[model samples]
Target: MNIAYPYAVSLEEDGVYFVQFRDLEEAFTQGASLEEAAFNAAEVLTGILAYRLDHNQEIPAPSAAQPGERLATPGVEVQSALLLRQARAGRSLSDLANAMQTSWPAVQRLENPHHWPTLKQLDKAARALGKRLVLSLE
Candidate 1:
C-alpha cells in the first residue's frame, strides 16, 4: 500500500525536536544529533501507524520524505527490505517463524506498516527469513 501523509519537522530546543503530521498530533524527541532526530521521527511515525492499526483506527496516508529527511528511518528501511527480500526469495512468514522458532505474529508485526520493529529486531527477522540486511551508502 502507498502511504501519503505530510509532516513538518522543527527544532524545539537545544536537543529537542518535534515532528507534526497532518490531522495527527505532534511527536517529540531529544536526539544527540540531527540525523538522530530524523531517525527517531521515523520510529515515531511507525509506532503511531502501528497503534492506529492495533486499535482498528483510521490511518493517515504517508507523507513525502523531505530532503535531509532520514527519508525512511533505519527501522522502517530494515522492515521493508526484509519483506521484499523474503517475498522474492519464495519465503513466507510461516516459513520464517518456523525456522526462527517464533510465532507468526512476530513476523506479522515486523512486516506490518503499523509495527515498526527495532532495527536490531528487523535485522534478526531478515536473517531468519534467509535475507541479509543491508544499508546503502549514499
Candidate 2:
C-alpha cells in the first residue's frame, strides 16, 4: 500500500502557508510560501512518523486524498521501517529472523526507523514475510 499521507495547505491571514495532516493531528507546520510549505509538510510528516515509530505509537494508515488535498510522504527510512513492521503482522522478531535466516537483532534493526536497511535487506525481509518489495516515484 502507498504510504503517502493526505494533507491540506491553507494560506493564513498573516500570509504564511499552513500545512496539516488529517491523520496525524500533531504534525503541522507553516512556511512563507507554497513551495516552502510543501517542503515543510514532507519534513514534518517524516518527523512525526519517526517519532511515532520510536515511541511505539500507532501509525495510522494514510487516507485517500480528497479533492484539492495534496499527498506528503515520509522519508525512505521511515517508509521501509513501517512497511517491514506492517508485513510482520504481529509475528515474533525471532520468527521473522528464522525466515530470513538472519540474527534476531538484525531483524529487529529492520524495524528501527533510525537504521537504514539496504535494499537487499528490505527485499529479503519482504520475501520472508511472503510479500514483495515495491518502489515507486511520486
Candidate 3:
C-alpha cells in the first residue's frame, strides 16, 4: 500500500529552511535552502518508512489529500514517491519543469504533498524522474 503525507517546507525568519512531514510531526529535518531541505526530507522519509516496516506498523493511511479528492489517479503516495525520487537525484522543481517544458508552478503543484496529479500526469512525472508507476486495487 501507498501513503501520502503532508510536508511543510518553509523558510523561517533566518536564512535556513526546513522540511517537516505531517505524518512525523515530532521529527523535522532542516537545510540551508530548499534544495538541501528536499534532499534531507527524502532521507528522513526513507528512514521513517523503514522503521515502520521493521516494526510492522501499518503505513499511515493515505491521509494527505483525502480519499476521493484526487479522482482516479496514481494516488498521493505514488506521486510523493516520485517527488522524493527526483529530489534524491538532485533535480530541483525548476529543473524538472524545464525538462518538461512547463511552468515551475505546474511542477510545484504536482509535488506539493497536499495536492494531487492526474493519472496521465503522474505517469509523466514518474517517467521524468526515472520511475515506473503501477496501480493495484486493494
Candidate 4:
C-alpha cells in the first residue's frame, strides 16, 4: 500500500502556510512558505507515525487524497516499519521471528522506525508474512 498521507495546506493571514492531515489529527505543522510547509508536513508526519509506533498507538490508514490536497510520505525507514507492522497483523513477534529463522529482537527491529532494515531482510520478513515486497519510485 502507498504510505503517503493526504494533507490540506492553507495560507493564513499571517502569510504562513499551515498543513494538517485529516487522518492524523495530531500531525500538523506550519511553515513560512508553501514549499516549506510541504517539507515540514512530511517531517511531522514521520515523527507522529514514529511516536504512534513506539507507543503502540493506532496508526490510521491514509485516506484518499481529496481535490487540492497533496500527499506527504514519511521517510523510507518509517514506511518500512509501518508496512511490516501492518503485515504482521495480530501475530506475535516471537512467531514471526521463528518463521524468519531470526532472533526475536531482529524481528522486532523490522518494526522499528529508527532501524533501517536491509532490502533482503525486508524481503524475508514479507515472505514470512505471506506477502511480497513491492518497491516504487513515486
Residue-wise lDDT of candidate 3 within 1-138, one digit each (tens)? 244455777778898886767666654788897778766776666566545534545445445544322211233444464444444366787877776678988876675544557777666776776666677564
Candidate 2 scores a C-alpha RMSD against the true structure in Å of: 0.8
Q: What ranges in model 1 sit over 4 Å off?
A: 63-138
With a 3 Å backbone cut-off (N, CA, C), the pairs that clash in candidate 4 are: none
Q: What lDDT tens digits, residue by residue, belong to model 2 across residues 45-132?
A: 9999999999999999999999999998889999899989988999999999999999999998998988999999999999999999
Which 10 residues in a row give candidate 4 its minimum summed lDDT? 129-138
TM-score (C-alpha) between model 1 and the true structure: 0.44
lDDT of 3 at 108: 69
Model 4: lDDT to the true structure = 0.95
Report the backbone clash tally of model 1: 7
Q: What's the true lDDT of residue 80 in model 4? A: 99
Higher-ranked by lDDT: 1 or 2: 2
**Tens-place lDDT digits, model 1, residues 34-101:** 67766666677666655654564654444666664434332454346334433435567688778767
User: Where does candidate 1 clash, by residue pair?
Assistant: 3-62, 4-61, 4-62, 5-61, 5-62, 5-63, 50-114
Candidate 3: regions farther than 4 A off = 1-4, 65-138
Give candidate 4 misplaced runs (Cα > 4 Å).
none
TM-scores of the candidates are 0.44, 0.97, 0.43, 0.97
